[model samples]
Structures are given as structure tokens and as C-alpha cells.
Target: MVRPSPTLRPLLLAGLLLPLLVGCRYTYLPLIPAPAEVALPTRVTSAALTREGGALVLRARVEGRFEPGYLSVAWFDSGRELGRDSVYLDAAQREATFRLEAPEAGAYRAVLAFGGNVLRQVELYEVEP
Candidate 1:
């Protein structure tokens, strides 16, 4: 059987504990800023139904301030994506308008993506028979 010398035993113990001491002092740094507050659209001013056409006219104003970067809009129906659009903004825009045709009646949701963050807003409408 072989045994470490007394001097070597303390050195080996210190080497193992050194990693633990350093690891305990370690902290994780955030890579990006935390999500900021996003304001939901206040009114659906241009939303309406027309008897002349089978499609429903949908329009709304989304108001919010976000960090300047790539922005995207994803339109959803009952959690399903119907369409999406993307835009690049160097400066923050407080308001934007979106227009789309509603082929059928169902619940709809809108999601805004900026950088690595996402904000969601939802609305529901029904078509008359």
C-alpha cells in the first residue's frame, strides 16, 4: 500500500478546496436588460363589420415604448399564428397601427417581439350571421 506524505496531504486538500472557495464567490451576470413595461392598445377605433363583404375589417393602435432594435408582429387566432410582420427601428416609436382582414370569427392575439423579449396583447370578436 502507498500513502501520501503529511506535507503532500495538506497540499492536495488545499487544491481541492480552492475550487470550492472560488465557485462559492461566483455570480451570474445578466446578458440583457430586464423586460420593461409595455402598454396595451387603448382602442379598436377602425374595427367594424360590413354587410357588403364577407370579411371583417380589423384595425387597432398599439402604443408602447421599447428599446430600439428589430421588432416583429405576430397575429394569432386562438393561440394560432395567422400572420407575422417584421420591422427595424433605430429609434423608439410610441404608436403603430396594424390592419388585417378577419376571414372568420374567433379570438385573436397579438405578440410583439423586440430583441429577445416578447409582449402579448389579445382581443376577441365575432361575425354576425
Candidate 2:
């Protein structure tokens, strides 16, 4: 049987412990910008665009404190409007979601808006049937 030297023992111990000590650090920085600080139109909290199956879903949240808001999404292909859908949200409901389907397999753009403010999302969808 052979024993490691004193210096080699410390090195081996450190190598074994390094993995356990890796992810235990958290740095606090007060200068970071949060999503709340951004300018919001009509007090809308969040907007999301995602593709589900062959349909595109757009969602927006309008806080109850704000007035009634309209959430609308327009589908565009090749700079032309293919279709649009909208929903009205009242105080009782703070969120609105809309789903629209693409006509064919290709790239398409979705324009999401709440009243006068607009946001755009682009996605490439392929379908096989």
C-alpha cells in the first residue's frame, strides 16, 4: 500500500470538494433593470407569442387597475395581412389570449397590440400531413 504525500493529499481533497462548492454563490447587484421599470402602454403587464402545433398563440395582460384594453393580433405573410383576431379585456379579466392558424407552411409574422401599442413576433412553421 502507498500513501500520498501531505501536499498531494491537500490537492486531492481540493479536487474532490471543488465540485460541491461550485454553485453556492449569489452576487447581489442593485443596478440591474427589472421588467417593471420599462415603459408600458396602457399598463399592460405582459405579452407573449408562441407556436402550438400549427397555430400561433398571442397573449397579453392588462392589469385591473387600468382601464379596459383591447388585445389584437394580426397575421401577416409576405407583407400582406392574412387575418386578425382580437379580444376585449375588462376589469374582471386581466388577461386575453388569441390563437390563429397559418395557411401554409412557411415563415409568418404576428403583430400583437394593445390599443395603440404594438409588438411583433416572427416564426417559421412547417407542417406535414
Candidate 3:
């Protein structure tokens, strides 16, 4: 049997373990980059309600390219929810319109929402012409 010197034993052990340690080093790469700040592709710029031919028409100015989603309006009178209406928007859409029954003469509020996110609130008043 042959015995290695103390210094040579450590060197032999290091030689055997060095390759394993080197192989164990991990190189990590992120699959996705960090998020960047960007504006939404579709947004409601303005909204209004008008009475036409005994009906209320909701017109919402949708600015930017329309993504396929639902643009909705929730009608409220005196802080009580009255009704809700929505229009399906596609890539070819540029504006949103919702026709609703004529509300009684009173002060009302209309909330415009897109993709379930509230975008704008409009105060409406209906009076006899």
C-alpha cells in the first residue's frame, strides 16, 4: 500500500473536487425582461349623454386603437344604481355608443368603464324640452 503525504493528499482531494465544484457553478438567465412603463392601448378620453328622440344616447370618445373588450356604462340616479349597459368593441372600433331608455327628469350620474375598469364619470341632467 502507498500513502500520500499530507500536502499531496489535500492536493489530490482538491483535484478530484475542483471539477465537481466548477460543474456546480450555476449561470442563471432571466426569461423575461423587467417591465417597462407604458400607457394603455385603449382609453376613454371623453364621454357624454344626450337625449335624442325620447331616448338617451351615451357617446364615449375612445382614443387609441381599440382592443377587443367591453365598454360599459352604469347609470345611477340619486346614488342608487339604476341600470347598466355595455357595447362590445373590436379592433375596428373607434368610438363607443350605448342607447338607453329615457330616464325621468332628474339629476343622474353615468360611469363609463372599459374592461371592468372605471374610466370616467359624467353628470347628466334630464329636463322637459
Candidate 4:
């Protein structure tokens, strides 16, 4: 059997405790932004939500000569842009999905835009305990 030396024991202990202490010190703020605007050029086939690896995933079905598309998930209410992530699609795709980070459990929307124009918007409700 091998045991860590006295000097090495402290470093190992500190490394393990550092993460625990850091985790407790951090604060998580959920997205509670103002209502977002809805302007659509055309409606896409469908937009829905599903759970993937414990994360909120927004999936959209789109088509046509979009060439370029944008996917975003945002929360809004009381007039503010709570939290949002907008990413450009590699290209126009029939099925696209974006994962929402630990957003505060609240009302949110997933929107797909093609060439700066929204193709679909779907409402989402995050159930929190």
C-alpha cells in the first residue's frame, strides 16, 4: 500500500475542497427578460422542445431556399431581454436544434429566423420546483 506524503496530502485536500467552495460561492441568475417581438416572414413546419442530456433543447423544422438561418432561445417579460443565445446555422437545414443552458425556470421562446426574418416561434415553459 502507498500513502501520499504529508506535503502532498495538503495539496490534494486543497484541490478537492477548492471546487466545493467555488460551487457554493457562485450565484445563478435565470432569464426573466421582457417580452420579445414576433415578426415572421413565413411559418416553418414545426418548432418543439425536448430534453437532451438534461438540457433544454429547442428543435425547429424549416425548409426552402433559406441559405442562411438563425436559431435562438430567449426569455422575455415585463419588457426586457432576459437571456438569449443566437447562433447562425451552418446553412439552411430542415431540422435544427439549439441547447439552452441552465436558464432560470420561466417562460421562454425558441425562434428560427432565415435571413434576419423569423420563420417560426414556439412558446416554452420551464417547470421549476
Clashing pairs in 3: none
TM-score leader: 3
Worst 10 residues of 2 by lDDT: 120-129
How accurate locally is residue 40 in candidate 4, as Cα lDDT from 0 to 100? 44
lDDT at position 18, candidate 2: 94
lDDT ranking from best candidate downward: 3, 2, 4, 1
Q: Model 2 over residues 1-129: C-alpha lDDT tens digits?
A: 999998799899989999888867765676685667554445556766677787777777665344676767787765678898888877687777878785456556677666667744544444321
The most accurate candidate by lDDT is 3
Q: Give the TM-score of candidate 4.
A: 0.47
How do the predictions measure up, each by TM-score?
A: 0.42, 0.51, 0.59, 0.47
Residue pairs in clash, model 2: none
Give the whole-model CA lDDT for all candidates, comma-separated. Answer: 0.55, 0.68, 0.77, 0.62
